[model samples]
Target: MTEHKPGGDLTLGGQRVHERLTREEPDLVARVLARIQAEVADYRRLPVEELAGDIARITQQTVRAFARCLREDRDLNAAELRQIGASAVRRAEEGFPLEAVLAAYHVGTREIFAVGSADAGSADVADLLEVADRTLAFVGTVTGAVTRGYLEELRTKIGQEHTARRTLLSVLADGGPVDAVARSAGIALPARYLVLSVELGPHADEATPGIDADIAIRRKLRRFLAAFEHSCGDGVLASLDGPGGLVLLPLAGRLSAVPEWGSLLGTAGRAAGVDVLAAADTAAPSEVREVAGRTGEVLDVLRWFGRPPGLYRLDDVLVEYQLTRPGEARDRLAAVLAPLDAHPELVETLSTYLELDTNRRRTAARLHVHPNTVDYRLRRVRDLTDIDPLHPAGLPRIIAALAARRASLPR
Candidate 1:
């Protein structure tokens, strides 16, 4: 074990000061504790029992160790340094901030020096200087140990929390014992959750040949997560990657409106500098697995139809969503558009005409053709399908047929 020696060898005067500090050790410990609590707000907020028990004991041991180092004319050995670091780990586990932990040590050291040097006269200059130098050395070593230990523990703790959250989300998305998983994760299962299945469009940087696409994706993900945290409080559980992921927002009992969460997609997209699409639904805790499945299906439906980026619920694309379902009805509707498929131009014209709300001029403008050409195409469609494009009754069928056709095509 390496022993840290605080510079010069201890002289007779340094020994005299150490003796005085040893005699006042008990009182000095008390003074250190009181001063730490008084000066550091974190310590002051600790419960009385903890303040008197663990904190007091640790403070006393630290003071004794410091005095012993001075008396032995050497600094803490590796084992003693490890002990100080272990105490810092304990403080981290107890949710003590690293700054507060360091503050406690600083306050303790100041009090120790003040008390040990209280009785020194002008003739005791060498003794006081030795004490000051030793105090600085001890503080430097102790603070470094505390910082390293606290940060290491904090990193481990954060990793554990992230793993737990992912586990909880997976169990909620798939079939599992949600209650037990939630317990293990130390998260309360809300009565209801707003489930979102997200898809992210590629950022421009992803296409730049010189740029690392993975790095761009990762940056977008970080921006997205930050946006989510800012818009929605930290209780949101999400599992996301570079492209996209799933999110589950815990809804407060009758207080949280689901629509509020739907707005997050736009904010997230803008922050990430990418287009975003999400399919959202609300479900109770028990129904999360089923609801998640449906939400993903809805998102798939949106992508199949080439819908614009935004938040979509089942209702947003109800007709298209239902038409894509496998059934005799969907097959029949898809067949309705098959006749016009032989003439690709007619099919294109009909689709553009309907999309333009039957405005022949707008359809003509979009197709870059004369209005007469659009009329001729519609007539050709009517001739082949025997479905009048102008009739209100036929309009519904044509629209449904178009949706069915688009849904059936290769995605």
Candidate 2:
């Protein structure tokens, strides 16, 4: 042990502390390992024999590093810090939380302090203070390095998992071979799958300005879908693409599960403070691209029609969707409704009357008007559009025009 001279510098004090720690290192390491294993639940859960070996090795290495810092009168260099950080990554990979790793460090620090202070018999007060300062500084550096390493490892792991999932989902969405992709993903292909196109309803971002609403909505949807996936024990794969998110949910046995899953997703979206518009179609893995394309069309039609936020299926908007496919057809249909632009109310009456099986009394009741008024609006609609609603041939064209108009309305 180095002799402590009166009025010596901090370096001398550090040397004294280092010598004391060196003599008591074995006992001090044992005490800290015991304290940590007893206090931390994670440590207690680890295999006893293997944990004992790991603790002994780690404690010895850490104590030796601390002793070198004290003797050399310097902080740990980058290499030393990196070593500690590497240990942190390993601990994190072993499923130990940052708190648990930090708690172990704290326990080690306490043990070092207890042993050093006891061995400080009749030492100068200034030397004791210097010892305390150096000890705290050393511990702080180690803790910060370990924290960085732990977080970095976590980020890396998450990024890898995200990339893998995205790749698999992309392949599935592109109609690639299911067996190859599923094997690569290490997940079994479900019997039936539903491809859903999800997006935030119009005006969903009204309250939250200056932020990327689309990204925000996509993130929330991902989280909600993840929870839903866990609840069902089925693999729910999702990816954020061009305008919205695509989710592929696997069903156990029946197409009947679509409504139930859609309902649950609706509830989840509402809870997240966004009105989600989801369009779904069921298909086998090989037909994922087909179903996804159909669902995408459903979403587009819903947007064009300014449909309310909710889950929609192909059957719900088939007519409007089919009619809007051909550009020329849509233009002609728009021309059909052109004459009725001056009589918007007549168009509304015609739509309502057609929806009510052309029943005059029902249409009047729905519009909160008299039956005579309904008759008058129907007459106006026919005169303006040159298509009588009472005529069978004219009624179909009138209905198609109405559908096109609804699909063309701005969202």
Candidate 3:
């Protein structure tokens, strides 16, 4: 391609006109165009030293592009306009304002034309200036609107990506994040404890009523966690899985960060009318099965012991609960377990059966009853409640009931 010839710097018009265009037009395109050719930087001359340096830089880029188009007679066709429009659309899609970018162009055009017209170039210079003005105005409008449309699509994609990321974190916290793609967000999660909080509040029931997990509640939880992060100090944060999703908080040490977390949780949970349980990692990680198992056991104590539900600190009370039938009543315990004695065998049988691996033969052997006797007792057991003792999950409930029974059992 032939190199374009360079042009003269814009001359301030005699006295009156000189000052008008000089202060207004920063990029003197007319002066650059006068020589019939302009180098890239020739369009960058500015008057006011104001706006720091940004105005000069933006104007420089635009002037260069406009000048290049002028010299090459580059057609601002469907493709170019669409691309520009797409750019504008993308911004709109991103939930950003379009008017700002377009307004800058408006200011830039007035500046360029006023300066350019003051200087002489060709017989058609006036016409060229007018056409340039109209084209840019049209381009600004088209590009801005088009970009917003694209931005709408762009934000939607971003929102989806955010949701997917949240889901992945849920997996990672539960055990591991899975996808065909790579996840390398700059967060470190080494939680010994995992708590899942569902966003709930005056609005929760009203929002996402059918979805089970409310979007607004999730947003609140996210905001709460973000606030909690600084207090977490060495903690890692991931997006909440959803209203029902869990958050994995890897403690730095034995409940090191948990003690400090109450106030923050209190403020956050108050809005929801209930504290979020931040469920235990309802499953185990293949990698840290043992530690996870211990953690799971600790969570069981918290859930069954009837401690108020919002947030519980296991590391501190863990040893106490781990020492016995989760710290229950005996003779003084009968005064303690008098409440549980009302359903004495219900609790006793469950506790004993679980201790014996839910095997009828072993439970019978442990309870010192005939195997048939154990079967009969279990049948009476099933008849009283919806809980199915034969099932493994019944362990948590069975254990708690027994503890409550142990609390109420007679001397």
Candidate 4:
């Protein structure tokens, strides 16, 4: 900003102003007309909306700063002011009406230039005019080159950070030093072993118009995480992204009153519209990394099956029976009823017969068939499957198979 002295003798106080504008303002532009013109040519290539926004924001900030400097009677250098103007030019959004920015430079310059004396200022007048006029011409080229460089640098860094975060989470699952990373990320760990999972949720496939997905997703994560403060005890929260985010909370360690807490918290998650599966690790913070590995199991279930969102213990949902080891236990039992397999109707008959306890009257009543038919299927099963319907081993295998099949059945 140029300041006028109270005395009649004018002095060029060029030390207080920003540099970019000094380069672009007329007193400065005249010296760099060729460069400035080339820059303006490049500005024309940018979209009008982008340019306009840039111009509005940049001018607003610069004008405000210039006004302050002038009011303060600051003695800024003329060269610095021109550089400030040029810097503002760089920030102008596409189609930012370079003319308006150039005009603003003049508006700001006139305010400060008045402080100087005709004798002293006239000496630098030619140089100032040259810098200002040329700023309009070369601003576009300088700004574009600078912007491209910045964008490349920003994108590279963002990619590196995202990949690093993912890798850290994976290693954390395998007993890596997660506490240090957690602290750096601003996560606090303490009592309260709880579960958290990230989900793409219902809108995964839906495209929202006029919304930048990255921005929207981040906003959503912030909102969701805030809700947990009241819902769980203290601990570090790291994102295990997918559908639901996994949060490892330290247990309060007084496990006396609420043994059924897993189900309790799970129910709350369901009500909140977040499907979360948690496995409780011990209360110790040192045990957290090991617990993180078990998170994969929760993730698997989250992916493979639709478990009702309710507090659930990992132990409670145990796989009590196996479908794969059919020959080892279940099949040995099944072999007793080999004849039953050969008799196509034996399965139905056995089910009905068991219900009726093989009583002819009850079997007939339940099957809606004659007693003779019931007896016939039973005999055929005994012949083919190699065991009588009344065999003790046969009953246990049948019960076990029913239980196994029930669980494997898709709901």
* Candidate with best lDDT: 1
State the displacement of the C-alpha of residue 257, model 2, in Å, after optimal TM-score superposition.
3.6
- Mind giving the per-residue lDDT tens digits that candidate 2 earns over 332-370? 886887888877788788877887788999999999999
TM-scores for the candidates: 0.74, 0.75, 0.43, 0.36
Tens-place lDDT per residue, model 4, 1-411, is 655332112123343233333433444333232233345565446566654565444444443444344434443345534545455435443224545445444443443333222223556564455333333333343344334544444556556655555554554545566677656655554543544333435333124787776665555445455545445543334573434556654455433235545544444444444444554434345555655555445444433333444444445444422331334664454344444444546667776676555576798788788988888877776666555666666654554443333333345
User: How good is model 1 by TM-score?
Assistant: 0.74
For 1-411, candidate 3 gives per-residue lDDT tens digits of: 645322222122322232343444443643423321122232234234422343444345455445444444454455555555554554454454445545545555555555545554565454444445544664565455455566667777667756665654555445554332223533343424444333333344435547544565565655556655554553443544343333445554433544444555565566444455432332223333344444444544554454444555455445435433434432232243333346766556666676666788888778787888777666666666545677777655555454444334333
How high is the CA lDDT of each candidate model?
0.82, 0.76, 0.48, 0.47
Descending-TM-score candidate ranking: 2, 1, 3, 4
Give residue 344's error in model 4 in angstroms. Answer: 18
Clashing pairs for predicted structure model 2, backbone only:
none
For model 3, the run of ten residues with the poorest summed lDDT: 6-15
1 versus 3: better lDDT goes to: 1
**lDDT assessment of candidate 4:** 0.47
Question: How many clashes show up per model?
Answer: 0, 0, 31, 106
Span of ten consecutive residues with least summed lDDT in model 1:
5-14
